[model samples]
Target: MGVAKKSIEEIVQAIGGKENINKASHCVTRLRFSLKDESVVDTETLEEVDLVKGSFSANGQYQVIIGQGTVDKAYKVLLEVTGLQESSKAEVKDEANEKLNPFQKLVKLLGDIFIPILPAIVTAGLLLGLNNILIGEGVFYDGKSVIDVHTQWKGFSEIVNLIANTAFTFLPGLIGWSAVKRFGGSPLLGIVLGLMLIHPNLMNANEALQQDVLPQWDLFGLGVNQIGYQGQVLPVLFAAWLLAFLEKWLRKIVPDSIQLLVVAPVALLVTGFAAFIFIGPVMLTVGTAVTDGVMAIFGNLGGAAGFIYAGINSLLVVTGMHHPFIALDLQLIAAVGMTYLWPVRVMSNIAQGSAALAMMFVTKKKTLKGTALTSSISAFLGVTEPAMFGINIRFKFPFVFAMIGAAFAGMIVAMNNVEGTIGIGGLPAFLNISPNFWSVYFLATVMAIVIPFILTLVYAKVKHKDL
Candidate 1:
């Protein structure tokens, strides 16, 4: 038989056909599709198609790994040839209405409530960590030493320092306002709830409760713990949303004569107490349980978890799942008081950066060399996508070596129980280390750089048969 000429339709038909394509999704550099059966697909011919980078199966799904800047075109071509429009349209619609979806709406609400305030929180955490370092070094007398510049700055620095140092002090108020905003409730109500948590009388009551010097509740049966909501999530947000709904419903039923005063008080009182007594505690318990479970896993896995974290993290960055993980880490820090994630992440970034640097060094092709150089710089600055998609994953061997190196180094760091004092990680982490851990921190940072360099060098030599 002579060579067969095939139209796009025929080509698509030969490769499992459009009908066999069950579902499809795209990330930064791949068109991931779920097919009815892998046997129906023609992988060899599909790889030969122009603009196709590579193809593979992962997570029980057939994936066509396109290169950067080509996934959209590939997806469009697939859509046209397959005559599949419904799933694509639904995806678009979902993207558009993501903020309105229940789970997504809550997430968005929480994000909006928390993100604007995150800089302040991170600053507070840094200040606290720095203070600890100072005290440990005998540079400061105590956590509250007025002589400390971090606490005693006269003018502008004083204002900035106050804001940073006082976050935990004012957390309840901040959380309350954010929660109210998130739930479309009265901001004043949130302020009131927050005040109850932070008031001196409440603190005294809490102390009394702790000592068992007083009964759990007064005449109102409101316990001290029930009202102490600071650095807390879930409960306050849920309560605020519940209040918003109740307020609106109550307004609908009240008579126009005394609607303003009567309905408002009743709604606020009912929702506030219910939230304080029931919803707040319930959500607090759930949040605490989640934190405990995560801590347990991390504690159990110890160093080995670092290797798994590093390997999977590189894959996540390559495939665009890394952003969600970043969000989760930030939330974990906020909710759980600290994190063990940054060291592994720092190693992974350095590994990818080193791989890009290696490619720049070895490649004779000017285009590849230039791409690698630029991506390497970006990776150093903590933007790893270009390096990951453009240089590392495209080369394959470098990416694998980078991940392996990262895992090894990350495991070593985790095994030492090394903790990052600062909220940020990656290259910036260098500036954020506590003075007490300076030696360990410096060693970890250097290892992050060195491990990847050596691994990439070895891999490049093995692959190209030349150093």
Candidate 2:
């Protein structure tokens, strides 16, 4: 307790004391602080502190890296000693955004809105992967799926398919709920708007394309397509923003006595009409175009696209710009059956893991060896921040070697056109790969792992003998 307290106190002082801290929060493995003055931070001293694994500023927050189990303890002690109430992640993010430029703030806003919805999306992805395994022909048995081999379990496979598809089927609701809350409006209203978009009365989005004439609402001799926004992301996001803006604006002008009765209906009615007429059609086209354009570029570039994306992905992770890609991956999956980006992302992750693993074998320092070993394992499990920020990036050359390995693996992924579901990555990522591409993806993954390990270990030993 005494040791922990001292470490927490030093961390506070090193970041220019408790007075400099505007808001503070913790996420998985780091203490994120929005400070009054970043220039006052003594990063070197903070990194030297016993409990702090490392420290860096990114996403408008000064993040002090600490191991998972220890970060909670440190955060608790920090709040107690500083006499600052523990801030919610959102609150801290808002405070952090005060320091960012307009572009950075916009990116951070998207990250904030989408992150809360990832759990549902990720769970859906895993379940989808499971469904793929069970129903995918030639995956388990030769030319037959588990259900095909055992007709008795056909009902079971059907149920799994139903459950796995729920999130994507009603993605607008998920995005609307999160985006509205992030924009500072009533979440329930956002949900209502989302539900209205995909109401059972409206024609299903997927089925509408097949019909010669879409179901339409005759509004004073004008025809409007009564189509649902199922699986659509951008339209939902825009609708949510408009809903929040309308709700806030209504609340301000409407008399408080009648506000409760008047505001909800007025806001919903206006937004619903606007969404059906303007936002939904326009943003859906925009979203489809964006996804199609991205795929076309990747298809045109083929291996070069993979090489470029994988090579620079680690740098994106470093700057904390990678969060928005989660939304993009999700978008691509919704537009198309699968995303090619995810396979390359997995390759990049394991390459960094392999590089860190290499350091464990070559480094003389016990602390460095331990960090490399554990972080490498973590990276293989799909979380690469520790390995990238803690081990590979810190050493410089290891990161370069990791990128080189990633580029090679990415080329293989692109040439073969490997594709997978979103949100699943690293070694267990094979489960998410399209069943047909499993063998080739595995081969590419092996190269991702081996090439980096060999390169980092060999280069470090030959060039930097001081270690």
**Which candidate achieves the best lDDT against the true structure?**
2
Cα lDDT over the full model 2 = 0.86
Worst 10 residues of 2 by lDDT: 202-211
In model 2, pairs of residues that clash are: none
Tens digit of lDDT per residue, candidate 1, span 1-467?
11122434444664688787666666667676666667888866775554454465533445565556666666666666677663552353234333244654444455556665667666775665544453444334533333354543334444545655576566666767767766666777776766655555443322333454443455365453524555555566677677677767877888889887876688678876776568866776676676667566668886788778876788765443454443345435546545667656777887788888888878776766776787787777766766776667766877887788778777776666565533444566543444445566567667767776777767677777542
The Cα local distance difference test for each model comes to: 0.62, 0.86
The per-residue C-alpha lDDT of model 2 at residue 318 equals: 82
Model 2 over residues 211-268: C-alpha lDDT tens digits? 7988788989988899887787888899899889989999999989999998889888
- Each model's RMSD to truth, in Å? 8.2, 2.2
TM-score of each: 0.62, 0.93
Which ranges in model 2 have alpha carbons more than 4 Å from their true place?
A: 1-6, 9-20, 39-45, 76-88, 206-212
**Model 1 spans with C-alpha error above 4 angstroms:** 1-117, 122-161, 167-201, 204-226, 240-270, 293-300, 315-337, 365-368, 464-467
